[model samples]
Target: MKIFEAMAGLMTDLTAIGKDQKNVQQGFKYRGIDQVYNALHPLLAKHKIFTTPEVLDKTREERTNAKGTVLAFVTMRIKYTFWTDDGSSVSCTVEGEGMDSGDKASNKAMAIAHKYALLQTFCIPTEDMDDPDAQVHEIAPRAKPRVSDQQVEQLRKALTVAGMDEAQWCASVKIPSLESLPEEKFGGAMDYIKKAALAA
Candidate 1:
C-alpha cells in the first residue's frame, strides 16, 4: 500500500488530547510539543513510519520601540519526510513563523514549524472541549505603508549629498531600492539618511 494510505489507516484509531495548561499564556491555550509527540509516537512506531524534519533555512528580524521593548520575528523553511517500512517515502516543505518578545524567538519558531509540519501531513485532530474563559486573541493586520514622490525625491537628494548611490543607501536600510522601502520602515530610513547627510 502507499505511504499516505498507511498513515491514513493509522490515524483512524487516534484521538485528540486536551490543550496543555502548563504553558498557557495571555488567556490562550496552546498544545505543547510534548503532547503532539506523545500522541503520534506510538502510532508511528506501530505502523513502522519514520518521520524526520530538516531545517532548510531560518531568518530573523528584530525591531526595538522607543520604550526599549524589543520584538522578534523569525521564519523557517522546513522539510518533513515520512518513510514507510516498505521503502516508500514522501516529503513536504512548509514555512512557519513565530513572534516573541525576547531571546526564545528562534526556538519558538522552530517548534511551531515542526508542529505544523506534522499536524498538516498527518492530519492530526485535537480534543474539542470548550473553555468558557478561553480568550480569542485576534488583531487586524496593518495596511502596507505608502511613500510619496516628494519623500522619495528627498531621500534621493540626501543620498547624493552623502556621496552615496541608491544601491549603497538601500544596503544601509536593508532594502532592495529606495522606491521599494516599506512604509513601516520610513522612520528608520530617514534616520539613516540623516546620519549619512551629517557624515557627508
Candidate 2:
C-alpha cells in the first residue's frame, strides 16, 4: 500500500489520547510521550507504517532561572519521515526546547520534538488541547534610557518656537518632563514639534 493509504488506516484506528500526565509543580496536565507511543505503535504496525528521525540542528546553553538556579537548556530541530512498505513516505520538521538542572536536557528536547512530530503528522486528537494563553509569565519591565540634557534643551526650544505649552506637550507624550522622554521617542517628538512650528 502507498504511504497515504497506510496513514489513512492508522488514523482510522487511532483514538483520542487524554492528558494523563500531571505537572505537580506547575499544576498543568499534558499527554505524555509514552502515552502517544502506546496508542500509535499497534496501529502503525498494523498499517505497515514506520518512521525515522533525523536531527537537523541542535543548540545548548546554561541559563539561570528566576530562583537563581542554574539549568541546562537545549533546543533541537528534528525531521521525521514516515514511510510505508511500498516505499512511499512523508516528512515533517519540528523544533523543541527543554530545560533541565542536570544532564538530560538534550534527551528531553529530542523526546519533545518526536512527540510533536507524531502528534502533528498523524493529526492525533487530545481531549484538552494545550493553550498558550492558559499560562502567564511575569517579566520585569526594562528601563529605557531617557533623553539627554542637551536633547531636553533642544526640545524646550522647539516647544517654544511651536507656541506649545511645555507641560501640555509633555503630558501628551505621557512624560513628566522633557528629560523624561525616552531617547527612542526623541526623533518622533522633534518631527512633531517641527510640524507644529511650521503650522504656526
Candidate 3:
C-alpha cells in the first residue's frame, strides 16, 4: 500500500520530460539517462522510495563491422526493486543491449536497462519524444549472381545461330557482357534467342 501510494505520488509530480538530447549521427531527439536521474532523484527522496538493481542474466560477444573494426556487443537482463520503509516493494525486469568498439558495452547496457526500468515503473510522461518504434532502417539489397562461363558460351552460340550480333544484344540488355547477365535472366535471354532463330 505504501509502495503504490509512493508510486502514484511520484507519477503525479513527474510531468513530461522533454527530448533534451539530440543524436547527431541519426538526427533525432531523445531524453538522456542524466535527465531522468536529475528529474527523479529529488522526487524519489521526497516520496521515501529507493531502488536496487540485480543483473539476472548477461551475455557478451565480439563482432567485426564492415570496416573491419572489432566491437563488443553486450545484452543484460536486469531486475530493479523499488522499496519503501515498511518492506513494501515492487520489481520490474527489463532487457538492454549495447554495442561499442571499447570496453564500455556492458556499462552502457546496464544504464539502458536501468533507465527503462525507472521510466516504465514510474510511467513517466515523455511527450513528443522520438520513439524507436517510429524509426525506419534501410537495408542494402543483396547482389545478384551473374551467369556462369558455360552459360555465356551457350548464349554466344545461340546468338550466332540466331544471326544476332553479340554487341548489339549486349547493348539492348544494357550489360557489359553476357557473362555479366544475371542468372535469373538467362532463361529469358535463351527464349529470345530461340524466337529470333526460328524467325530467321
Candidate 4:
C-alpha cells in the first residue's frame, strides 16, 4: 500500500488531543510538543513509517545591552524525511525561527520546526487557528524605519550628558513617551538631540 494510504488508515482512528498550554496575554491555547508526539506515536507505528529530522543549516543573532542583558534569536532550516517499510521515502524542508534571552534559542527553533513539520504532514486540524489568506495584511503607509535598542540607549546617554530632561526631549518630538517613539522618527530625534547639544 502507498504510504499515504497507510497513514490514512491510522488517521481514521486518531483522537484529537486537547491543547494543554495557554498563553495568557495572547488569550489562546496551543498543544505542546508532548501532545504532538503523543498523538503521532501510535499512527507512525501502525503505518510502519519512520521519521528522521536533519538540520540542514542554522543562523544566530544576538543583541546585548550594556547592563549585560542579552537576547538571542535563531533561524534554522531543517529537512524531515519519512520512510516506509517498502523503501519509499518523502522529505520536506521547514524553516523555524525563535527568540529567547538565554542559551535555549537553538532548541526552541528546533522544536518549532519539528512541530510545524508534523503538523503539516499529519494535517492536524488546529481549530479556527488558521489564516486562510496569506496576502491580506495591513500595509504601513511607508516602511517603518529600523531602530536598534543600542541606538536608543546611546541617545538616552547623550540626552543625560546634555543635562536635558528625557521627558521634555520626547515631548519636543511629539512623542508621548520615549518607548512610544517610532523607528521612522529616530533619525529626526537624533538630529534634534545633536542640535540641542551644539546649542548647549
Candidate with top TM-score is: 2
Clashing pairs in 3: none
User: lDDT (0-100) at residue 62 of candidate 2?
Assistant: 97
lDDT of 1: 0.79
lDDT, candidate 4, 1-200, per-residue tens: 46767667766867666667898979888888888998888788888887799999999989776677888989999999888888777788999888789788999999999988888777776554545675577866975555677877978987987789998887777777666677777778877788888899
Candidate 4 residue-wise lDDT at 157:
82
Instruction: Please write out the lDDT profile of model 2 over residues 1-200, one tens digit for every residue.
Output: 39998898899888999998999999989989999999999998999989998999999999999999999999999999999998999999999999999999999999999999999888898878866799899999999999999999999999999999999998987889898899999999999999999998
Candidate 4 segments exceeding 4 Å error = 64-68, 134-136, 144-200
Q: List the residue pairs that clash in candidate 2.
A: none
Candidate 3 minimal-lDDT segment of 10 residues: 122-131
Q: lDDT for each of the candidates?
A: 0.79, 0.92, 0.92, 0.81
Arrange candidates by TM-score, descending. 2, 3, 4, 1
Could you tell me every candidate's TM-score relative to the true structure? 0.58, 0.68, 0.65, 0.63
What tens digits encode model 1's per-residue C-alpha lDDT throughout 104-200?
8878888888887777777676675454579687889976776777778878887788778889768866777777877767777777778978977
Worst 10 residues of 4 by lDDT: 126-135
